[model samples]
Target: MADIGGKRVAILATNGFEQSELEVPRDKLREAGAEVHVISLESGEIKGWDLKDWGRTVPVDRVLSDVSADDYDALVLPGGQINPDILRAEPAAIDFIKAFWADKKVIGAICHAPWLLVEAGIIEGRKVTSYHSIKTDVVNAGGKWEDSEVVTDQGLVTSRKPDDLPAFCAKVVEEIGEGRHERRAA
Candidate 1:
């Protein structure tokens, strides 16, 4: 396993997030020794969408307007059709994603979560993978889109769907442990 001890991972999402997309990776990352914080657009708790219906409610650690990119080692965007759709429309959320990239921190976006990356204008020239339906959007945004279960380019790691969770979580833990950009590249 990767040595992600003491690293801090910020998961940015909101209500209606895909339940497995958020919970599975979050649990795995935490178990790997990363301190995970869930930041959302609103206060209180954000509801999750399970496979076919509503599921658990995860508490928000802080509002997007209040968090800083420098405070964490990585950023995670857990996707559901509605979650990233709403977040992409929020300037604050878009800015948060931009800041994480500007800082060169590890960024993980699964499924439709790449919508946030497109909204942030950071997808240009990058190679990424996302849910099959959003590949067009990713390509249109200038990203070299792929159909792989997980794709890591530069410092970002993206996955195609919930079924890719195991590989997705493992890569996140690996990247967070890398800590430095040069080490991450090699």
Candidate 2:
């Protein structure tokens, strides 16, 4: 595991997040020695969506209203059909994600989580991959969509689905260790 002992990571999600997508990466990042926090739209716990039914509930470390991108070294967006959909509609969530992008912080978005990137308008001209259902949305948003298990461009990391979690988590840790990226001007 990569040593990120002093780093702090934020996983942004809401109800309906894919259970494995959130938990697996969170556990791996913690194992790597980074402090991980779950930030959500509300206080208390948020329920996850398992394959065909609702799954586990994760505690909210901080409410979205009380946190800022400056508080963490990296951000993870775990995808579920409904999680990103709800977050994309949220003005605060969009702004928060954009702040991370503007600051060049390491960002990892898997599956439908890329939808939030689309909503934040940061995917333009970048390479990314997500669940096939959202490929068109990503391409339409100017992202170079691919079918790979994992794709990293600059400080941004994306993966196709739950099966890609291992690769996704590894790249995210690698990118975080690389520190902030200097995004090119449009």
The candidate maximizing TM-score is: 2
Q: What are the lDDT scores of the predictions, listed in order?
A: 0.89, 0.95
Worst 10 residues of 1 by lDDT: 177-186
Candidate 2: which pairs clash? Answer: none
**Candidate closest to the true structure, highest lDDT:** 2
lDDT per residue, candidate 2, 18-137, as tens digits? 999999999999999999999999999999999889999999999999999999999999999989999999999999999999899999999999999999999999999999999999
Q: Per-residue CA lDDT of candidate 1, range 1-186, in tens?
A: 686888998999998899999999889998998899999988899999997898899999888778888888899999999899999999888888888888888999999999999999888888899999998999999999988999988778999999999999999888877774531321
Q: List TM-scores for all candidates, in order.
A: 0.95, 0.98
lDDT of 2: 0.95
TM-score of 2: 0.98
Candidate 2 error regions (>4 Å): none
